[model samples]
Target: MNYEGAVYRPPSEARSLIIQVTIGCSHNKCTFCYMYKNKQFRVRKIEDIKNDLDESRIQYREVKRIFLADGDALALKTDKLKEILEYIKLIFPECERVGIYTSPQNILRKSVDDLVLLSSLGLGIAYLGLESGSDTVLENVKKGVTSSDMIEAGKKVVKAGIKLSIMVISGLGGRELWKKHAVESARILNEIKPNYIGLLTLLVEPETEMFKQIQAGEFQLLKAKEVLLETKELLNRLTVDGCTFRSNHASNYLNLAGELNEDKERLLKQIDDALSWKFGTKDEMYRRL
Candidate 1:
């Protein structure tokens, strides 16, 4: 078994594997992203992906899960995605589940039946980027999906009985719009009540729109402490039913995990205690990080 296209593995993968099917983000206009900027989007030839799947099965016979990648695998047409999913099952019969990074535009275009068919084919998870729920911030970031659109997309996934993990950027709106960012994000999360709410704090890389904004003095990058405050504000307003919350990314100042409804207050207090610390120095915060 030979793979024609290049393969990239995430540092965090131990039991998980990423199978690249596309080259770049289909909708790569997000201001905060620089992940796949240098490449153009293209769906790999089906035979190439099938070969990779067969090779992966041979190399990692004990693999339990797989994540399709190269920005957004869901961007592939439904029948094409279905073929890939079925090929995965055929090669990795013991594989328990499969996940993919999905764009809202792609998800919106998918009918519930298509999602359900995919789910029944062993597609267990969909990681959606719901960066900021404030329509203004979404527009500014070029997210290409409104808060309402995101909510609808989320509901459809839930209705299809598939697990939905929505990722939100903590400091996306920066200082000027921090309040709205947190409040609207919380409101959207509550309405959607996705199975998992994952958070990634903003990290500026050169050549990204966000970087240009910062250089032009239009966007204010928050200090680590300020990020913690914004996280607290979000946690304060988030009142969803029973979604699990996670902020364990290395980019985040603090990592927290717990059930949303039961552990919301506890997590908020953790943030408050960290922020109120008169540890009296920027050095202290740096030391903690």
Candidate 2:
């Protein structure tokens, strides 16, 4: 099989399949993201995408799940996305689900009909980078979409009957607007009440605008303890119904998992226990690894 030119799959996708149908992120303007900067954003031709699927099926037939990449496969036109989905179904008839990363800006542009069509074509889940629900925070980070826009867009996606996984970054507003970031983000999540809420701790990758702010001492990054406090505050404010929460990344100093309705109190207790123990010590941070 020709593995050449295919991007490496992230370890996070060990249980899923990776299908590259796009070259890079459609909106690479988010300040904290460095994932797609090395390449320009463009959708691959349907034939090329089908070829990649053919190659994958030749090696591992009948996979149950897949993740379309690079960065926001939904950015493709609805017809193209549907064509790829049809090819996927033809190739892997046993495939049960498929997901893709999506930018709120891209989603906002899509009509409800387009979203419903994609959902009906087996685009089961979407990973959305709803970094912050504070308009100020979003603009400060150049997220390219406002809090209201995200809410409206998220509502449409949900209305289309697709499972939504919304992600927010802790410490995104750094220290200046930490409270706003936490509160506004929680409010948005509460409104959307997505199927899943994934929390990501911010990391300033080199060459991004955020990294320059850090070097110039313009943005004060939150301490690990400070981030935890902000996370706890955000969690305290989130009152979503039946949402699953996860911060399953090495970047997070602490990991958590809970359902909104069933384990909210338990998750809060876990956070409180960790906090009361004076846990954000340097030792604790390293030990979490």
Task: State model 2's lDDT.
Answer: 0.84
lDDT, candidate 2, 72-98, per-residue tens: 878888888988898888889899888
lDDT tens digits, residue span 213-259, model 1: 99999999877788888888898888886788999887787878889
Per-model TM-score versus the true fold: 0.94, 0.94
| Residue pairs with clashing backbones, model 2 | none
What RMSD, rounded to one decimal, does every model reach? 2.2, 2.0
Please report how far candidate 1 places residue 179 from its true position, in Å.
0.5
Worst 10 residues of 1 by lDDT: 3-12
